[model samples]
Target: MNSGFHGNTFAVIIAVENYQFRIKTVDYARNDAIAFQQWLINNLKVPQENIKLWLDVDATKSALNEELQYEISNLTESDRFIFYYAGHGFYDGGYNKITTWDTHPNNIQETTVSLNRILMEPLRNSRCNQCLIFIDACASYIDEQLVSRDFIADMNTKEFSDFVRSSNYRAMFLSCSRGEKSYGSPELGHGIWTHFLIKALNGEAPEAVERERFITSTSLQNYLSKIVPDYIKSSTDIRGTQKPWAEVSSSNTFIIFEVSGASSEGSNNYIDFIFIPERLIIDFENDLIIAYLRGLENDGRHFLMYDYEGLKEIDVEAYCIRISKLKNEIRKILEEIMDFLMEYEWEEEVIFERSDDKFNISAFLYEDDKTREITVSLGLSLKISGLHPMGDTIFDSEFDVANDELKIYTDSSDYNVEEVEIQEIFSDCWDEIRRYFLLEKEIEKELLNEIDE
Candidate 1:
C-alpha cells in the first residue's frame, strides 16, 4: 500500500482588533501577518491554489471561537496548517488562553478560549498531518505567582498530561514562555522576536541565502535569536527578553537565490582568453618576435625581441622558465603596464590596406602646441613622418629614415595659397592623422592586453 500523501497548505492570521484594542497597535500585527503570508507565497514557491489564508482583524470571542472550530473541522490528513495569533495571551491557573477583541482583563472567561480546547478538541478529530502554531500575545504577570504551584498540580491531572502527549507532529512557536509577558513597542512597531522572524522569512535578515541550499529550521531559530535582542536594545528603553521557539518534524529545508560571476562588457568582436605563461613567438610573415624575462633581473625593460618572420611553434615551458628567472622585475613591468592601460583612453578606427600585412607607426610631438600626432603607413620601415615648421612656413612630409630621403611632400602651395603660414596649414591636416592612428593604437592595445592578461 502506498501511504504517502500530499495536500493543500493553509495559513490563518488573527490580528485581533476588538473594542478594547488600539487600532494603531493592531495595524502593526496585521501588517506583519500579511508580509509573512506574501513571503511564503512568493519565496517558498507555494502555489496560490494550494494555499488559503484567513485574516480576522477585530473578531469577537464567539466569532473567533467559531472560526477556529471551522478551520480545525475542515482540515484533512494531506493538509499543512499554520496558525498565527497576535494579541493578548493569558494563563488561568488551569489553562493558557488567547483573548478575542471583546476580551478584558476583568472578564476573562467570557472573552477567551482555552488554549487546550483550541488545540485538542477539534484537531484531535481532524486529518491534519502537521500543524505550526505561532502566538504573539501578552502573558499575565499574575500567572507567574500561581504558575509554580498550579502547574505542578496540573501536571498531576490526567487530562492535561494526556493532551500534551497526544498532540504529536505539532509544534508551537511562542513569543514568550509561560508566566512571561510579551510586549510590543510603538517605536519598534511589532514585537521584537516577531520582527526578526518576518525578516528571516522575507530573505533579508543578514546575508542572502544561496538558492541551492535548503533553509533549515535551526537556521531560522538561530537568526531570530541574534536579531531580536539587538533590535530591542536599539529601539526601546525597557530591557525585555524576546525568545522564539520552533519544533520542526519535517525534513524539508529552505532554499535562497543569489547572483554570481563577472558582468559582460558590451562588444561584438571581443574574445576573452585566460592568461597562461607560454613562449609567445609572434610571426608577421617576414619578422619573428621572441619575448622573455629572467626573474627579477629585468623591470620595465623585461621584454625580448626577434623578427616575426622566422618563427615556428615555441617551447612554452622554456618561455615560462625564462620569465620566472626574472619574476620580480617582470612583475614591476607588468604592474606599470596595467596602470598605464588603466589611465590611457583610446579610440578605435578600421584601417584598410591593399596588400601589406605589417605596418609602421610614427608619432610626432609638436613643441609649440604640446600635442602629439601619430601617422601609420603600410610597407614602411624605419620612417619618420611629421609636420615641419620653419619661421612662419610649414610643410608635411614622410621621410625614409635609413636613407634620410623625403618620399612624400605637401606644402602651403598644395592648399592653393602663396606664402601661407606652413605650421598653421599643417596643423589642420595633423588633426585627421591623429584621429586615425589613435583609433588603430587603441584597438591594438586592447588585443594585446587580452593576450597578455
Candidate 2:
C-alpha cells in the first residue's frame, strides 16, 4: 500500500457533456472528465467501487448531495478524495460554481454546485488525509472565449513557500490562472491541460535528478508548473494560454500512488521519457537525461498522438531532468559544434567561467579562433567587444540578461531546464555575438530591433 493510500482512495468524477435545455456545450470538457475516470481506474489502480462517476444528465445537484457529498462525508483520516469537474464553470464576478447539465443562466446559484462548498468546506472538516480537486472549466460564463481553462491553483499570500506536516492535505490543480484562458489542441481530441494531466498522474512525469519517482505533492506541483505553460506558449496558432496553479499545503511525503511496487515500477521505468517530435533532435539517450523515451507505444501515451502536432502538448519536463553532465560537458559539446563549423573555415570556442557575481556565468566565446571574440555574461548576454581606456560602453549590446540558469541534478526536487535549454540560450548569445562583430551598419535606424528577429 502507498503511504497515503491503503486501498482507500476514492474519487467523485463529474463529466458533463450535454447541458439541460440545450445550452452551449463545451468542446472537450465531457471527454476530459470521462477519460479522467478511466485513467483513475486503469492507471492509478483505484477500485471501481470506490469511484462514483456522474456524466451528462447524471451530474446533478441531487446526485452530488446524495452521492458525491455523501462519499466525502464518510471519508476517514486515512482516506483520499479526488473531486473533479470537467464542464462549464460560472464565475459571476465573486463566487465560482460548476455549471451542470440542468444549470440555468437565470438562476445559477440554485442550479450549480459551488466549488468551495463541495471540496473546500467538506474536505477541511473531514478526516480525509488528502483531497485533490481538478477543475477543467472556466469560471466566467460571460467570458465564453476564455472558458476552456479552469484549473486554478491558488495559495495564500505565502502558500507556496510554507509547508506544514499534516495528515490531511487540501489542494487545487486549476486549469489556468484567474484571468487567462485554457485552449484546446485540435490535434488532441481532449482539452490540452487534461491530456498532459492524465500523463502526469500515471507517474509518467519526469523525476528530478535526485529521485526517479514522482509521488509527492512538491514533485507533481513543480513538474506541472514548469511543463504545461511551456508547451502552450510554444504552440503556433493557439490564442489563449494556460499556466497551471497549485495551492499545496506542503505534504512532500504525500504519495498520490505507489511507485515502489513491481506493477507500477515496471511501467514507470519504461515510460521515463516524454514523446519528442520527429524533427527536433534533442538526444535524450546521451544528453544529461537518464529518462529517455522508450518509444511512444511502450510509453502508453501513443494513443493520444494520432497527428504530429499532438507532440506539442506532451510535458517533457514533467518526466525528465537535464543536468549539466560531468565537468566540461557543455564545453565538449560546443567544441564538437566548433569542429563542424571549421568545415566552413570559421573557428569557434565556447569558453565559460563563473562571473564576478556568484550567480552569473561569464565567458569568452570565440567566433574565429582567438582573433575575433565576444564576452558573454550569463547565457544570453553579450559584453561589448572594444579597445577603450575610458570604457567599452559605447558599442555594448543592450540585450537584457534575465535569470542565471544552472544545470543542477535532483533526486526528486522541483524540475528545471536541461541541456537543450542551455544550448539554445548560449546559442542565442552566440547569435548576438555574431551580430555585434558582423553588423557594422549601426548607422541604420533601429539596429537593435533589426537584430532582434
**Highest-scoring model, TM-score:** 2
What TM-score would every model get versus the actual structure? Answer: 0.45, 0.53
Tens-place lDDT per residue, model 2, 372-428, is 532232222111111111111101112211222222211111222344443443343
Q: Which candidate is the best by lDDT?
A: 2
Candidate 2 vs. true structure, TM-score: 0.53
lDDT for predicted candidate 1 compared with the true structure: 0.43
Estimate the Cα RMSD of every predicted model relative to the unseen true structure. Answer: 32.9, 16.8
- In the range 250-364, model 1's lDDT, one tens digit per residue, is 2222212112221223312121211122233323233432333222211112111101122233323222112122222223332443344357653321122121112122222
Give all candidates' CA lDDT scores. 0.43, 0.50
Q: Per the 3 Å backbone cut-off, how many clashing residue pairs does candidate 2 have?
A: 20
- List candidate 1 stretches off by more than 4 Å: 1-6, 21-27, 45-58, 142-168, 185-188, 206-212, 249-453
